[model samples]
Target: MDLPRSFTIRESSHRILNPFTDEKLATLGRALHLAPGTRMLDLACGKGEMLCTWAAAHRVTGTGVDISSDFIGAASARAAALGVADQVTFLHDDAASHAATDPVDVASCIGATWIGGGVAGTVELLRRSLRPGGTMLVGEPYWRREPPDQAAVEGSMATSKDEFRSLPALIEQFGELGVDVVEMVLADQDSWDRYVAAQWLNIRRWLDRNPDDELAEQMRAELTTAPVRYARYQRDYLGWGVFVLMDR
Candidate 1:
């Protein structure tokens, strides 16, 4: 199984596939104080950046699973490129039913919580793969401020205000799930710009090369409106972060 060609085309150049910069990702790794040989299981692990980098920096070993065969291939190459091929592995498979063959020191589902339906279900799913005292990392978006109306929500790319909770409420959500919020690294507007604006350029470059591709028109339409929509709604109203949690 694989992701839609359009999805890969839009993010072909993205290494992290999220709003997070490499520096931010490194900071999170350091903050975790990852011990050598720590084992991690990452679900929906786009491009395997997190696993590969951590394998290098922390000498951790991990397995990453994603639905995108293209990403999995890239992730495998990345592992070899980083000289950590032996430490990490990437699988092209659905993450929704993925459970670690052995309990791991850390389990994560970053950005793609929909693999487990939603935050609560995702947390539950990750817990199945985590050791008793191991950490769980969840990356998600929250509302920076309450949207004034449905239009505002739609502008932020959310179908409803309930799609994301406020920052405090998100923390409370982890608590309700019987997990302690231990640490977090958040994304700023600049990070959002880096993530969203980069897509326009990728789409433009692709269109220049493959103007007659089946998805070119759709990409062109998105490029036309994405910038304004992002700056006006997403950059201000939405905030994203990777949170570290432990069973309470």
Candidate 2:
């Protein structure tokens, strides 16, 4: 099983595969105060950046699972490049079915919670792999401001306004799930630009090399319009963050 070729093509150059920048990710890792030898299970771990980097910086060990073989290969290469190959492992498998063989110090489902159906279900799924008192990290988008209408929501890449809650409401959601929101690192417009705008360059470079590829036109169209759409709606109205949670 793998992500659609188009999706991987669009993000071919991405390391983190989310809105987070390298500096922000490092800051988050430092803030967590990860102890040496901490075991983590990261589901839908695109490119395995989080696991690989943390393994190097915090001296932790982790397993990352993702459906994309391409991403798994990239992740493995990253681990080796970072000289942390022994500290992290990447599996090309469906994250939804992945359960840690042993309880881990951190359980994470970042950016791709649909693997567990939604936020609540994803939390339940992560909990199955987490040790008591261990941390859970969830990366998600929240509405920075209420969308004025359906059009606004659609412009922000959401099907409906209900797709995301406001920032406060999202925090309340974690509370309702019996988890304490302990720490978070948010993405600002600049980071959002870095994430979204980089796709255009990747798509353009891919199109130049593989002009006859089946998905070229689709990528071309997206590259043409994505910047405007993202700046107009997503950059201003949508906010993303990685939140640290602990069982209450």
Candidate 3:
């Protein structure tokens, strides 16, 4: 019925949640040749920025689905603010089971692949929403280098170290899913820093506003320690990218 608080808070602040700067986002749109009338289904569409921005850019219509109600509300407001409410819709639902009412030109599962278990399963789930020959956009992390220990991997995820794959293996995993990596945009260390560090600021702000709230204590603990863990483990050992996949 709910997603983690971190996701909801991140949704309310679009600028911080988006690790990719404008230039990078624009590059992704261009890489996909996003033009007017192109349809996209943004799975795990946090705050709906990717969907809303693409809708505005392409004059297209689409739906965004996420389990987080707070995220869905924020995303809906964003679409309205962009004057594209009619063109896009946001729903509070599980991304894995969100079947489209109509087939789309593209389907995307960015950053949140747990809905499908992993990249391969996620790709298969998204493929159900695409028209024949349509594209799927997947944003995922890959290991830049191996982590030094189990603790390093745990810091990168709330889950265990078994949750991820190395970069080359991830590419091959996509191939195993019957997807060709048509295009991709990489995130540099600066982008990673922006994404991970911004969460600390959000947590700090939350603590300031709600000092007595039980959740604030958890937030404070996370704020105090997350950055060090990220910088020490995840940041140096991992890289992320948005890959454009086409059914082959």
Tell me the tens digit of each residue's lDDT in model 3 across 28-113. 88778777888879888877888887788878789999888887888898898989999999999988888787899989888888
| Global lDDT scores for all candidate models | 0.94, 0.93, 0.81
Better of 1 and 3 by TM-score: 1
Give every collision pair in model 1. none
Per-model root-mean-square deviation over C-alphas? 0.7, 0.8, 1.7
Which ranges in model 1 have alpha carbons more than 4 Å from their true place? none
Per-residue lDDT of model 2, residues 1-248, tens digit only: 77899878879999989999999999999999999999999999999999999999999999999999999999999999999999999999999998999999999998998999888999999999999999999999999999898877998999999999999999999999999999999998889899988988999999999999889888888888888888788888999999999999
Query: Distance from true position, residue 92, model 3, in Å?
Result: 1.5
TM per prediction = 0.99, 0.98, 0.93
Candidate 2 Cα errors over 4 Å, as ranges:
none
Error of 3 at 141 (Å): 1.0
